[model samples]
Target: VSSIIVPITNVMNDQYCYQTSKKIRQVFDYKRRNGQYIGSNPPFGYVKDAKDRHHLVIDPDAAEIVRLIFSLLLKGTSKRGISFYLNEHGIPSPSVYKLEKGMTVSNKPDGNTLWSGRMIHTILTNPMYTGDLVQGRFRVKSYKVHQIETVPEEEWVRVADTHEAIIDKATFEKVQELLLRDTRTSPQGRTVHLFSGFLKCADCGRAVTRCSGKNNVYYACATYKSRSRNACTMHSISHARLEAAVLYAIRQQVHLAVSYSEVIAQINSAPIKKNQSFRLDDTIHAKERELAKVTRYKQSLYQDWKDGEITQQEYRDMKATYDRQINEVSDVLARLTAERAELANGVDKEHPALVAFKKYQNIDALSRELLIELVDHIKVYENGNISVKFKFADQLRRIAEYIDVNTAESPAWAV
Candidate 1:
């Protein structure tokens, strides 16, 4: 009776195993048909079958559409804007094209009929747009689940010029640059403003959003706009007013910057200690010595590990401690080097900030280009007191301090 029961259990096991194997094959077949196997892989045209993997060909029309999409995105059109542009013009999306031909497609979001930001961003970042075919960017964990992990970019299988590029290299690079620039902001915490992310609201710690009425541009508190009167009041300011204040402040700073150069020149021409050059060198050398000492200490911890004087865990912890000390020393050395270089280069005479500011020295008014170049941010406070911050203000302030310390007499040009 025991042997009969064992045979029955063995029969049950065999049936389960067969069913599991069959299901596994079905899943693999589904994946192969739907392109999920190469979903995260680089676009290398359509793959017809397993045997014909290398025989894939480029779809010229799809390549042309990709180029057009890249152009629209680079022109400051948002992803939604691009999708609308495409759909309104009766261009079929990738999903739509597949569906029309009765091809099975997966991974589409429910209830979405067309293109989306994720799709556009994917296309924008796709190296295929630049005529490079990428493959093996992700992988499934197991046969039971569809979860996938992304492969590192460096490890991705890349084939260059596998298809005609939709966008040129230079244009693609320009789009990338534009994308890298900080642009969008969520102010009011609900609606996004083009300029909302660009400006900061001083009172409520929210971004100021742009609003237009009767041909006038005004910025208001984003929190107040979304949450209501309970949150915050609308710290409203007109665009024209903001623009005027910013331009005026920039011009004033430029004037100050130009004057600073003259003051530095005056101070440099004055009689000072001729031996000060050696002092600067001594300061730099001392920093370098400190850096070397920390590096040597860090190396000794590794030596302890090699000599079997420390456990693996203890060695790791001690090495980390020494590494942190080394980093701190390195940071100090870098600062000292920069300061020494500044002193040697007659920093007051040839600072990049000073040079850039001097270019507009004779200009009467500020231009858009000038504003972007010099200004970091302009925060409008609750009390209507605007604090204008210039780029590299710390360096400028340092120069001012140096002038105060070194100059025997105050120059007329010193602001």
Candidate 2:
């Protein structure tokens, strides 16, 4: 009886291992097959074939249009603006071009050819534009793994000057710099005012959007503008007035920063006291541990659902709760990390905002970049205090707090 039982158990264990290995292999195979094909041969104007390892020739006209589109994108046109421009001129998108070329392409509104942010970003970032053909930047570790790992930059196989330059190297670099900078306003469907989407009408709880009046732009509560009778008052603020106030506040902050530079310099020159260093290190470690725990909890909740241990509703509710907690914790962790970094580096005497403000300070006129970098919002509070939040207010506050704690004298510029 013991011998029979032992053999049965051994068979069951072997079968279980085989089944698990088979499932793992299937997942691995799927991942290996799922990635975009990157080959030594140049596809030029076409995507790789679905099954065969050959370039499917694209329409010549369409290819020309692609080059044109890339050129415009590299010239720093926003994706939505590009889309509008293309559609307005009756320029055939890639999908339309394919269709016209006798290819049976899907006729969806946002088909394979829609000019989207991701598409524009990809084109701009693609080293291919710089005459460097890079392939296989991403790959699956195994056939069973669903996760794709990015290959490091140094490992990328790059063939230099593989194609004719649509955008020059200088212009491409400038576009990349712009992309890296946080200068993008809301999309084209939204208003163009730098403060349009940023500002919220305190009373109406809607975006303070721009309206044209007597050839001047004024911000009005969107909700009140639409539903005048039912909603709150318009709470309109003149664009000139709002812009002036925001700029003034930013200027004041910059002035304060400049004035406080002596204190900042002194602080940087001062020796890092053991207690202060320990405090910063401790705070960072604690925040890191908290972040890890939250992440683990979030992962475990997902795993529970994947394992069929939790019902859909339960999973959603738990996930939402965990997500909110995780977000709050993440924000805290970020703040702590920033604080630690500042402590470690001896915070720059001149903040980026201060430097930017100084450059534009002499101009006497506000540009879009200046507005974006300096101002966060110009909120028309219900209490009648037009609160102007500067973009670097949090950093300023942190600096003030650090100064107060570390030094005997109060920083004269602390606001």
Weakest ten-residue segment in model 1 by summed lDDT: 188-197
Off by over 4 Å in 1: 1-60, 95-118, 131-134, 146-165, 168-196, 201-206, 211-216, 221-236, 243-287, 293-322, 328-415
List model 2 lDDT by residue over 1-415, tens digit each.
Answer: 9999999998899888778877975664454344323453333345435565422333355556656665554444555666766777788665555556565554544635555555545666766555445566776664346588998987665555544554566556655655554334444542233653457787766677777777887777778787674777777777788777776776676677776666777877888631144445567688778878877887888789889999888989988987888788788878877775675555567766456555554556565555545666667864434776676677776666566556654336532
TM-score, model 1 to reference: 0.48
- Taking all chains together, each candidate's TM-score versus the true structure is 0.48, 0.48
lDDT by residue (tens digit), candidate 1, 275-366? 12444456778877877887787778778888998888998887788788778878877776676566555554778778877787676654
Residue pairs whose backbone atoms clash in candidate 2? 27-143, 27-144, 28-143, 28-144, 29-143, 131-161
Which parts of model 2 are misplaced by more than 4 Å? 1-191, 270-341, 350-358, 382-385, 409-415
Among all candidates shown, the one with the greatest lDDT:
1
In order, the Cα lDDT scores of the candidates are 0.65, 0.62
